[model samples]
Target: MTDPNAPVTVTPADDMPASSAKAVQALALKHLYIAWVRFQRRPESMRSFIGYDLLYFPPPYAAKWAKPFGYIRQAASTIAAIRRHKPDVLWFQSPPTFFAHLLVAYRALGGRRLKVVADCHNMGLDPDVPGNFWMKIPGTIPALNSFDVVIAHNAAVGAKAAGLGVRSDRLLVLETRPAPLPVDETAGDPVPQVILVPCSYHDDEPIEMLMEVAARVPDATFKLTGNLARAQSKNYPARAPANVQFTGYLSAEAYTHLLTNCSLVIGLTTGEGIQLSGANEAVGAGRPMVLSDTQLLRSLFGDAALFAANETAPMAAAVQDALSRQGELRQASRTLKDKRERRWRLQAEACLERLVP
Candidate 1:
């Protein structure tokens, strides 16, 4: 995260010829016509894909009494978008318990012509706890049956989907992969001391634990980046040690710069569904990581990461170990980066072919 105190500057894109600009604009329009349908039951918020012209369906409700009606309104809006956009593919991030029934409605209304894909980022439920057996309720079962394709973020999630009766051919395991680190390694001396913790500061997140660890590792400065408004509104703990700084929201380039220079990365999410993009970015940049002992983290990093139990003492120890053996960790990080790049490229190609063919 850039120092909030530092002066921010705007840089223009390199000059492009008139012909090239026109060609690029035309290509964007063609892709725009081939929209990707997304069902966002939550209120308008800055998610990762905010810039994309994907359809959003915000669940309605100001009071607890109107929750059910709000969901119905959102589902109706989702159906309307599907009919209007008629996207080649219907991609859902995950099935929320309150809105899973909407999938069945979409399939019935949109018909079999549109391909339905469920991108499973976690096991069919919350991350910290094992999935509730009752999630196999009838409402969820039919919704799972509606998808033409199922994409899991990891092999474990793929297996879980299969166990829930999704066919093997329909399931695609696309592991979270990091974008290539920028080639310009011109970050100056002393590295401006930064450590990034990216994720929502929700209750399940081990924010307090991380804060304790940060307090212990005073030498390595820490920076927290994510939805700061939500954090503040939700009353998330604001007592981060004096050394820790918060960067509300950052542009892609700014965040990437911090990741490149940061000495280490730390994540303490408990959700099995939590995919650690920052961890992958850290690995790509050959930086050491200290992560919580969640199933998703274990599968993604294997033995490459320094893992600790949720408690503060163990978490602190893991961070210390990562800092101590930084060299070995950096080498392991490079190996993971190579493997992820190849896997993601292959998966992306396959997805594009399926969409455009």
Candidate 2:
């Protein structure tokens, strides 16, 4: 049984076993990363290169009324973890931007000499723009501006932080690289599969358009992953082709199996300046991809994925093209993984340099 009193630390990424220990020893900085959420692959993978000891504190209760109490417990636990670890560099995942506010208060009141950094996601960077009332609380921007360094997913997100008064040099652009899930040893499904990962069922994703694509390609199975309720609440199609299947809310094991066995992974979004976690997953698994054609996606994916417009015809065409050239696109994905991993190392190292005295 896991000990409730003990501090929870992240295990090293399977792909980069030496990353945490080696980087910490070479840099001579003890780094500790804290998050209020259950789990996120971005921080998990980033810790592999950045060598930060991860401390995850998932909320204690599910009830909405208990959130305030949950935040109080989380704040106390965060302070306890920091005191126990005594890291020279403290990194916090913001949007719970209040955690950063708490850290700043902790430094001011407690007079701790720790170098504070924030890994700001899009919502955290601009809560006002997203209009997420819970996150658009007072001091959101000021707390963000107070961080010693801000790690952004891309230059576009970093610019938002800068506009809010964070110093330019202190803002670092570091994209997410999802760690691959371990595929089962058993044989894959006999029918060819194409996965479409729409995690949030947001406005930008063309959920209805997927039905059109599935109709066009009747031979290959089309599986969509994420919450069924959210999809249904949105403009999701009531009826899809026989080949279209919704693998709603998959277990980690099932998700890994489905992603690994699929011939192609398609994650299309019209949202500007956002990076797709699904695209990163495709790269991690070395699966062929069909992604939306946007500046951010095109820049990050390059020749690795088939780019398509959000319309039915173009998306269907791209899906077909990726399915036909699975072998070639799979190899390209592997190659892209290598190139991105190398780039991530440099980017992580550069961000670390700013933390050094």
Q: How well is each residue in 168-221 modelled by candidate 1, as lDDT tens digits?
A: 656777666554565234433234446678765665577767778889988878
Candidates in order have lDDT scores of: 0.59, 0.74
Write down the lDDT that model 2 would get. 0.74
lDDT of 2 by residue, 1-357 (tens): 343334444434423533444444434677788888755667766765556688778889766689899999999999988888998889888777678778878888974688888887776775443344535667766665676778888887677777877778778888876464543334333354656554667666777787888889888878887767666666463676788777776755667677777888888777766778888888887888898888879998976999988999999998888777877887788889878877777677667667754
Question: TM-score for each prediction?
Answer: 0.68, 0.82
Model 1 TM-score is 0.68
Residue 219, model 2: Cα distance from true site in angstroms? 3.2
Which regions of candidate 1 deviate over 4 angstroms? 1-85, 95-100, 110-112, 123-138, 181-190, 229-236, 249-254, 271-274, 284-286, 294-296, 324-331, 345-357
